[model samples]
Target: MGPVRAWRDEEEIELGPRQQRAVLAALLLNNGIRLSNDQLIGMVWDDPTPSAVMALRTYVYKIRKTLPELNLKSRDGGYTVRAEIVDDCRGEPLEGLRSAYFDAQRVRLGDSRLKAREDCLERELDVLELQKHVAAFPLRERPRALLMRALYLEGRQGEALDHFHQVRALLIEELGLEPGPELRKVHAQILNGDLTLPRRPEQLVPDLIDFTGRAEEIAQALRTLPGTVGITGMRGSGKTVLATRIGHLVKGRFPDGQIFVRGRDVANELLRAVGVENPVGDKAALWREKARGKRFLVVVDDVQDAATVRDLATPGSAMILTSVRRLHELPGVTWLKIAGLTEREAREFLRKAFGPVRADAEPEQAEVLLERLSRLPHPIRVIGGKLSSRPGWTIEMALLQMERESRLADVIPSDCAAMMAPLIAAEKQLSEPERRMLMCFARQDAEVIDSRKAAEMSGADAGEIELVLESLAGVHLIEPLVLGRYRLPRFVRFCFGLRTAELTS
Candidate 1:
């Protein structure tokens, strides 16, 4: 009615009370159609006298002056406001000025469902309610983000972009934090201005994988001050898997990031991976350079020495490294050698791999099988795979096979031996009596023993046990438990045990 009004707002508009009431009254009466002089006078000032007509004219003049600036107008003897008809084929209004209409609708409806008497009218209101929720989303990175979305919907692309940038800059200065990942992706899309929207998969929520058995020890380590976690264990003893899983739990709070690196005392293998061929002693510098600019969740697996790992960690990056030995001399790095998977996780892994064996499918047999598997993931997997192929095989049958190989001292593969080559070389540097004591202890069947008992078994003096255990612990051959207690990480134990047994034989 008023030149097909483009939806617009006055850049700045302030009106006195009388002017505001008078203009609002006219717009309400003449939503799109024009209001004649007499009609305007009756609407704005209820008096029907001649001066009332003059007052209406004065109000109309002031409104007209402001209206033009916002693209409204008066023509001939009447005042008219423009109505925008969106071009939508299905009668669903196209975005543009209609977005302002939607925004107003959302505000009016709020959270309440609109009700109507007629079924058709009720259906229409329902559609408007849904459209309001979709188009006028309340959560955004900032208020200006919402404003930008509104303007973009209203076909004011240029203004929307300007406002978006202004908001981004404002947030950057106001909060030191950068825009979140979601906001960054949204901004990139707006900058591209492609109408196509991306649909991302809903994130899968996390569930706790049952880590029964070691709960107390793991909890104690996790609760330790400074949050530095160190894990050492044999290959295939669940050390790597446990480190990764725990790192994930710890990283939620350290969002600047966490790092995991597979470390070896022999740094050359990894040095080659990070583009350091012929790496001189400056490997840490090369490593730090590679780590620069990335806020990472880093996992260094196969760690052989604490010093090597400390050298690789970029401070401020929470780090998790795995090794088969403890490096006690390396200060500040928290030392925690990971234990084998508890009886439960190991059994679950077996059940998953074996596709439900008689032990799980048959409750009477479950306990018997769990005992035979000894709660070690590698052995459990091997045995489970074997059992899966031969369903009728009894747990006792698998136990016999496990017992034979399990007692064969150390049976680590040559490739795994390659992983510990540098540590092996470091062991050679130990004094002969220390080496012989390690060899004798390595040949023993048990995985853990007190230092005094170890000395007795190796025929060494009790006083000498502490000093030798300290030296071996430094090179990571074994880890001390308490004052006199000590245990070997599965892999380190297996490797050394194998070596010690072979040498003795």
Candidate 2:
């Protein structure tokens, strides 16, 4: 079902407009099946016009006229095209095709091709390839089972079991069920040595287990793909985590594979992924050549600047970039900002960490805790995990310490060292004046601080403070408000407070 084409012997048949071709693809994907006019229209058009039924008829007529070798019949008010299906799946299924229905078919076809490719392998298995399969179809037990076998064969029994746990957690959480029997059996086989072995997979980190919320943003970013999507947020607000989730969901949409670039050596990481090894001159050109005629994804995490990867986000495939900066200058980019979790989402994180019963017992206290944490994901997760681990502590007990807490650092759990890494790295990127202004923001009590207030606090010229404010706003340390006002986001302010407190103490 890859790259839909019709041929009579050595001669290839021509197709019509994209919509008409879409009709053909739908018919081919569901070959020899009875498709009513409504079905065809629904698959090909999002908002079918009044002439949709007529248009479907015309497409059918054109198809029959163009390729008279095949049978295109209409009976009982339904259409059917009879032909022998051919599938090498050389490239993406129906490449250059974009439609929700086509997207679904592409995933189905991609999975089938993956299975076929695995079956043909004689001795060795490419674990990475199977990982992509599992990522694309997370709930599909077949890929997970297959992955288990591959891992077991490679003597990576521990990793195989880890994969099992990841999938089982996903199943129980997402579907309110355990892994399917087939999947459990595969896990049993691996654990008991009866068998083989297997998201957010292959070059990407596993998505956060308690990836709480951001439903609307996720949907919008996904809808904006086949183009660039920029997710900008304050440090530790879960930008990378959201991008990774999107990367997993769109894994099937891109047939080639997904490449994740996190640090320096971006050129090498991308080039080598596509077999353009040791690319010397014009690596961009080589990348373009490889990207052309293929569907893949590039998820650049925590990008420092938009210009750095402007050329890489070209037309060949989709890109998702997570940055603390706004990336306002990047062409053809749609930006989504993540400030922090909603109160509901924050509570959900707590619920997951401490179990629903405990979390619900003190909804009032939980709300107070959420306000104090500012609903930022990383700190919430860290703090939630911390409180969860110490069964002796309750939400109220934690609140008591926070209420009288002078050094915010004193309140942080000792085990949450990793939580500060993002902030520390972000601090390194800021200029001295910007860093000074950020701490000034921490010391201020105002909700929205203007340049004058910053100047008053820092004892700097108002004009110079304005520049610093703009810089901080550019990187999203402070969110710009109307009439020249700005807010140091709750989480960043909290972190700055911690920094200030530690120094003073």
Candidate 3:
């Protein structure tokens, strides 16, 4: 009687003695199926008694009298609790008695009815709860798929995709396997925008809730001539943030959709964004077809090479590529170089990030903290999040910690290591001379180094050094100053110095 209890309306009916309960349970178990007199006797008493049949009869009579609604019928020299009453019974069957079968039946009932109830807000909530319950079971794809469908139907496509990714991540992490094809099919359907919902202009890029500056840059990117605009900046220079802000502002122009791709597989990401599944031969061709006549905005973020920009770019669609490397000049591609925030912009960023209380109480300390951070948006955001989470720590304490700890890991959040990983990877791809030229800046006292100066330090050809410097600048590893000189950011210089020390020592 654990999860199973007999209830007659508001009253709980007593099922009577042990033998009587056993008999009632047996009839309920074989509900609608007649149980022979011999079967009932065997079930009632493990060892048949001379009077077991009579005892069974008595139990049946008592159950009938106790619950008249059961319609327990004696037929073909046997007894059966009618089939209709089984549906009304709330509790599960006795242990080892078709529990698996019954549970599946219940799930099927819920799943089959989900589509009918999706249009009702109240019913959809109930379906969500039921789907959540079903998803908790192992190897059950139907529930999660239905949940995704239900969410899409409710006009929460982003949440739907998010839920699928969570499940996919968990499965891959825990079991070393991907979700089943059924789930992938449902995901493809959602991405394709098959569900009939009003097409409101959607901004798929996450909101920059604490977005601080870049007003002029955002305006320029929005007004740029119709073509791909390349945004190059040092790692964590707020290129992606600025691009996303531009996407949101110009989303009104692209009524079809706005897609943001962060992965290396540009073709599949674009296809998936617009709802294509398992694209076959000629990925670029397929991308063009799907994007044809669709005035959408595509923001390809964290691009490492020019080929990706070329592959993802579709004619007639506005494309924004954010990268650390300067892409090889492609036709119709205008470049936007992002620099660190100005003094005023940096101060306002810190004020907003640290909140008014700290900014107002210690204006000088805030300024000192921003200066130590080199006015870069990434560190400011990372350290700002850490400070906000720990109210006991002040801006001055953070500054002191950064000064005392020279290692990037010690000064910045652990996740910042991931942001720097791409730059490190890009460095690995360079030739020995190229890498040496960039490392010379780390060994130099001056912040700015010209091609001739770098050639003198590294003993490489001045023209070759110039090319390396240009490559480095293209990737935003070093900043290009006026008069053909390049300078590394203080943070990048520090990182390079660390790498140089490691190689030498």
| Top candidate by lDDT | 2
1-505, model 1: which lDDT tens digit per residue?
A: 1111233464445443553444544464345887787666655444357777666667666666655643456678777776433322232221121223344433443322221112122222243343344245433353334344445555667876775566567667877556566456545666778533112111112323633345554575566423456676534455666666666566554433343344354345444544457877777777577555333345667665556666655554445556666556656667675545666666666667566546566554655555533445655555566777787887667556544543555564443345345446656767987777766665665677688677777677888888887777755556678888777655554445656754555
Clash tally for model 1: 14
The TM-score measured for candidate 3 stands at 0.54
Tens digits of per-residue lDDT for model 3 on 1-505? 2233477778887877666777776677577888999987766566677888888888889988988888888888999886433333334434222334345545654543443233232223454574655555545565677677778887888988998898898788888999999789889999998754323235467868878778877777776834788888777788888888888777767766788888788878888776677888988888888776457788888886666657556655788888776666666777888877988888888778768787667788888777655688887777777787888888878766654443433233354444345456667877887787666677563588787767777787877777877877766777788756977777676556556655665
Of the two candidates 1 and 2, the one with more favorable lDDT, higher being better, is 2
| Residue runs of model 3 more than 4 Å from their true location after superposition | 1-203, 311-316, 407-440, 443-445, 482-484, 498-505
Q: Which stretches of candidate 2 lie over 4 Å from their true place?
A: 1-201, 314-316, 403-405, 408-418
Task: Provide the clash count, candidate 3.
Answer: 3
Task: For model 2, state the Cα shift of residue 99 in Å.
Answer: 26
Best by TM-score: 2
User: Candidate 2: worst 10 consecutive residues by lDDT?
Assistant: 194-203
- What would the TM-score be for candidate 2 when compared with the true structure? 0.60
> Which candidate would rank higher by TM-score, 1 or 2?
2
Taking all chains together, each candidate's TM-score versus the true structure is: 0.42, 0.60, 0.54
**Against the true structure, candidate 1 has what lDDT?**
0.54
Output the better candidate (1/3) by lDDT. Answer: 3
